[model samples]
Target chain A: MKNWFRAAMAIFWKDILLETRTKDMLLAILIFSILVIVIFNFAISPTPKMIGFVAPGILWVAFILGGMFGLTRSFGLEREGGALKGLLLAPVGRDAIFYGKMAAMFTLMMVVEVIVFPVFAVLFNLSLWIPWLIPVAALTTLGIATIGTVFSAIAMNTRAREIMFPLLFLPVAIPTIIAAVETSGVAIRGVELAEMSRWIPFMGAIDAVFLVICPVAFNLIIED
Target chain B: MDDKPAIEINGLTKSYGRTGVLRGLDLKLDWGEVITILGSNGSGKTTLINIIGSLTKPDSGTVEFGGIGVRARATSIRRFIGVVTHEHLLYEHLTGYENLRFHADLFGISSADERIIIVARQLGVEARLNQLVGTLSHGTQKRIAIARALLHDPPLLIMDEPESGLDQEAQGMLDGVIRQLAESGCTVLTTTHNLDKGTAMSRRIAILREGRIVYDEDLKSSTGADGVKKAYASHSGESM
Candidate 1:
C-alpha cells in the first residue's frame, strides 16, 4: 500500500512538471475554453433573468469540452515515445497508474476552471462572488476526470482517439455534467452552500460511484 | 533463496488474427545464466520477450519467474525484472535525469540521485543526463534507455535487439556491461540477429524457428561465430 501511494504520487508530480515545462496541455486547454466562452458571449444574448439559467450551461460546456480535449491529448504524451510501456514495466500496480493519471487530469481541469471563472464573470456581467460554486464545480470535475481518464486510456491506442474519447466519455458522463450545471445554477443565484444540500448529495453519489469503478476498470483494460 | 529456475515457460501459444506468432513454445533459464535468442524477422522473438517481461499476456501458457506465477503476480514480479526493447520508452520533453528519477521513484528507490548518476556514468551519458531526451541523438537516446533499464539493478534483464541503434563503441561497451552483469549473478535473456555478438555475450544460444526453439546449445567460450552461423542457418532456415 505504501509503495502504491508513492508510485502514484511520482506519476502525478511527473505529469505536472512535464506540463508545466512545456505549457503544452494547460495553455491549449485554457485558450480553447476561453475561446468557447468568448464565442458563446457573442452567440447568446441572454436577458438578465435568463442569464442565471444560461450561464451555467455555457460555463459547463466550455469546461467539459476543453477538459475532453485535454483528456484525449493526455495519453498522447505517454504514447509518443512509448512511455506507457515504461510505466507498465515499473513495479507499480495498475490501480496506482489510474489514480495518478486521474489526479493529474483533475488538477489540470481545476486549474483551467480557476482561471476561466473570473473571465466568465466579466463576460457574463455577474458578480464574481460565487465562492460556493468552486465546491460544486469540483465535485463535477472529479466525476469528469474519473470518467474521462478511463475513457482516454481506452481510446489511447486507437487511430481516431480524439473523436472516440467523447463518444465513449460524454454519454456516460451526462449525469455528472447535469449535476454540475444544476448546482452551479443554484450557487450562482446567491444561495448559500446549505441551499445546495439536495444537489450536493446527488453529485457526491455520482462521484462515489465513479471513484469505485474507474480504477478497477483501468486495471482490467491494461492488464487484459 | 529459492532454487527454482530463474524463468520457466511451458506450452506458450499466441496468435494475431489468422497468423500464429508463438505456437506452444517452451524455454527455461536457470539463475545467473545468460542466453541469447536468434530468430528470423516475424518469428516471434519480440512476442516471446514481451510475454516474458509481462508486457503482453499469452493466449495460452504458464510462465513462472523464480517460482512465482507471472500472470497472477505481475506487479510484484516486476520488481526483479528490467526490459529494453525497440521503443525507447522515454518521455521526450523531460530531461534524461528526470526520466530516470521518475522510474527510480516508481521502483521505490530511496537513493534515486545516486543511482541515476551511477547508471548514467555506466552508460557514458552523464554529460547528456540534463538534456531533454528528444534533443539527444538516436544512439544517445538508446544509451539513456539502457541506463533506465539498469537503474534498479534488477535480477533479470530482458532486452530485444538492444544494439540496433548504438555506435560500434557503444555496442562494445554494452557487450561488456552485459558480461559484467552476468558475472555479478544477473540472469540475462536477450535477442539479436548478430551472431558474433550473440555467441560472445551468452553462455547458451537458442534459435527460434517456426514459433519454437529448434536449437539450444551451451557455448564453450571459444565457440566461433562461423560455427554458430552454420547452426543458426540449419535451425532458423535463413540463408546466411
Candidate 2:
C-alpha cells in the first residue's frame, strides 16, 4: 500500500516537472480559452442584464471547449516515445498510474480554469464573484479530469483519437457540464450557498462514482 | 533462484483476431544463461519475447519467472525484470538523467542517482545525462535506453534487437556490459537477426519458425556456430 502511493507520486512529480520545463500544454489551452473569450466578447453585447442571464452559458462553453482541447492531448505525452509502456513496466499498480495521471490532469485543468475564470469575468462583466463557486469548480473539474483521463487513455488507442474522444466523452460529460452551468448560474445570480448546495451533491456524486469505476476500467483496458 | 528456472513457459498460445501469433510453444532458461532468439519477420519472435517480458498476456498457457507466474504476478515480477524493446520507452521531454531517475524511483531503489550515474558511465552516456532524450541522436538515445534498463541491476534482462540503432562503439560497450551482467548471474533473453553476433553474444541459440522454436542448441562443440547457422538457414529459410 505504501509502495503504491509512492509510485503514484513519482509519476505525478515527473509530469509536473516535464510541464514546468516545456510550458507548451498549458500555454496552448490557455491561448484557446482566451481566444474563445475574446471572440465571445466581440460576438455578444454584455449588458448588465445580459451578463447575468447569459454569463454561465458563455463561460461554460469556453471552459468545456478549452478543457476538451487540453484533455485531447493529455495522453500524447505518454504516447510519445512509448513512455506509456515504460510506465506499465515500472512495477506500479494500475490504480497508481490512473490516480497519478488524473491528479495531473486535474491540476492542469484547474490551472486553466483559475486563469480563465478571472479573464472570463473581466470580459463577461461578471463582477459579482463569490467564494461558493470554488467548490463548484473543484467538483466539476474533478469530474472532467476523472472521465477525461479515462477517455484520454481509451481514445489514445484509436487511430482517430481527436475525433473519438469527444464522440465518446461528450455524452457522458454533458450532464456534469449542465449541472455545473446551472449551479454556477445560481451563484452568478447572487443566490445563497444553501440554494447551490443541492446541485453540488449531484456533481460530487458523478465524480465519486466514476472515480471508483475508471481505475478498474483503466487496469483492464491497459495492454500492448 | 538456482533451484528454479529463471524463465519457464509451456503450452503458450496467442492470436490477434483470426491470426495466430504463437502456437503451443514452450521454452525455459536456467539462472545466469544468455539466450538469443532468431526468426523471420512473422515467426512470432516478438510475441514470444513480449510474453516472457510480461508486456502482453497469452490467450492461454502459463509463464513463470523464478517460481512466480508472469501473468498473475506481473507487478511483483517486474520489480526484478528490465525490458528494452525496439522503442526506447523513454520520455523525450525529460532529460536522460530525469528519465533514469524516475524509473529508479518506481523500482524503489535507494541512492538512485548514484546507480544511474554508474550505469550511465558504463554505457558511455554520462556526459549527455543532462540533455533531453529527444534531442539526442539515435545511438546516444539507444545508449541511454540501455543505461535505463541496467540502472536497477535487475536479475533478469530482456531486450529485443538491442543493437539495431547503436553505433559500433556503443555496441561493443553493450557486449561488454552484457558479459559483465552475465558474470554477475543475470539471466538474459534477447532477439537478433545477425547470426555471427548472436553466436558470439549468447550461450544458446533458438530459431523460431511458424510460431514454434524449431532449433535450440548450445555452442559447445567446435563446429557449433556453423551447425547453428546451417540449422537457422534450414529453419527460417533466410540467409544472413
Candidate 3:
C-alpha cells in the first residue's frame, strides 16, 4: 500500500509538472472557459430575477466545456510517443495509475476553478459568502475529472480522439454536472449547506461509484 | 533463490477473430540465459511478446513467471519482467532526466536524483539528460528507453528488435550494452531478423515461420551453408 501511494504520487507530480511547463491543456481550457462565460454574460440579458433562473445552467456550461477540454488533452501526448507502454512496464499496480491520473486531473480542474470563480463572482454580482463553497467547488471538480480522465484515456486509443471525448463524456456525466450546478447555485444564492443535503449525498454517490468503476475499467481498456 | 524457471509457457495460443495467430506454443526459459527469436513480419512475434509481457492476455494456455501464475498474480509478476519493444516508450515532452526521475519515482525508489545520474552516465546519456526526449536522436531515445527499463533491474528483459532504426555505430554500442546487461546476470530475450547480430549475441536461436517454431538450435554448433539452407527449407515445408 505504501509503494502504491508513492507510485501514484509520482505519476501525479509528473502530470502536473508536464502540464505546468507547457500550459497546453490549461491554456486551452482557460480560453474556452472564459469565452464560455463571456458569451453567456453578453448573449443572455441578465435581469435580477433571471440571474437565479440561468446562472446554474451557465456555470454548468463552463464547467462541462472546460472539463472536456481537459479530458481531451490529458492522455494525448502519452499515447503519441508510446509513454503509456512505459507506464505499463513499471512495477506499480494498475490502480495506482488510475488514482494518479485522477489526482492530476483534479489539480488541473482546481486551478481552472480558482480562475473561473472570481470572474464568476464579479460577472454575476452574487455574494457567495460561504467559505465552504470553495471546498464544494473542489469536490465537484474532482467528480468531473475523476470520470473524465478514464474516458479520455480510452478515447486516446481511438482514431478520432478529440471528437470522441466530449461525445462520450457529456452523455454519461450529465447527472453529476446538473447536481454540481444546482448545489453550487444554491450556495451562491445564500442558501444554507444543509438545504443541499439531498443533492450532496447524490454527489458523494457519484464520486464513490466512479472511484471504484474507473480503475477497473481503465485496466481493461489499457490492455493491448 | 530457488531453482525456478524464469519464464514458462504451456500451450499458449492467440487468435484474431477467425484467424489463428499463435497455436499451442510452449517455451521454458531459465534465469541468466540469452535467447534470440527470429521470424518473418507477421509470424506472431509481437503477439508472443505481448502475452509474455502481460500487455495482452492469451486466448488459451497458461504462463507462469518464476513459479507464480502470470494470469492470477499479474500485478506481482510484473516486478520480475521488463520489456523493450520497437515503440519509443519515452515521453517526448519530458527531459531525459525528468523521464528517468519519473520512472524511478514510479518504482518508489528514494534518492532518485543520484540513481538517475548514475544510470544516465552508464548509458552515455549524461550530456543529454536535460534535453527533451523528442529532440534526441533515435539512438539516444533508444538508450533512454533502455535506461528506463533497467531502473528497476528486473531479472527478465524482453526486447523486440532493439537495434531497429539505429546506425551502424549505434547498433554496435547497443550490442555492447546488451552484452554488458547479460554479463550482469540479467536474462535477455530478444527478437531480430539480423542473423549475424542474433547469432553473436545469443547462445540459442529459435527460428519462427508462419506463427510456429520451425527451428530451435544452439548457434555455436550450427555450421556453414547447409545449416542456413536447411533451416529456411524446413520452415518453408520443402525438403532440401
Which of the two, 2 or 3, has more TM-score? 2
Give the per-residue lDDT of model 2 (tens digit) for B1-240.
568899998989999899999998889999999999887778887788788878888999889999788888888888889888888889999999999999998888899989998999899999999999999998998888888888888899999888889878878888998999999999999888778888878879988778887888888843599988999888876674
Please give, for residues B152-215, the per-residue lDDT of candidate 3 as tens digits.
Answer: 7778888888878777876777778778878988888898776666766677788777666778
Per-residue accuracy of model 1 over A1-224 as CA lDDT, tens digit each: 99999999999999998889878788888998999999999898777888889999999999999898889977879997889999999999888999999999899999999999899999998888778797898899999999988999999978899888999999999999998988888888778667599889999999999999999999888874
Q: Which model, 1 or 3, shows the larger DockQ? A: 1
TM-score of chain A of 1: 0.96
Q: Could you report the Cα RMSD, in angstroms, for every candidate shown? A: 1.4, 1.4, 2.3
Best by DockQ: 1
Local error of candidate 2 at A220, Å?
A: 1.6
TM-score of each: 0.97, 0.97, 0.94
TM-score of chain B of each: 0.96, 0.96, 0.91
User: Which candidate would rank higher by TM-score, 1 or 3?
Assistant: 1
1 versus 2: better DockQ goes to: 1
User: What lDDT tens digits, residue by residue, belong to model 2 across residues A33-144?
Assistant: 8888889888887888777677887777777778887788778888988888889988888999999988987898889988888888888777746677888889988998
Clashes of each: 0, 0, 0
Q: By summed lDDT, which 10 consecutive residues of candidate 2 chain A come out lowest? A: A123-132
Model 1 segments more than 4 A misplaced: A192-195, B221-224
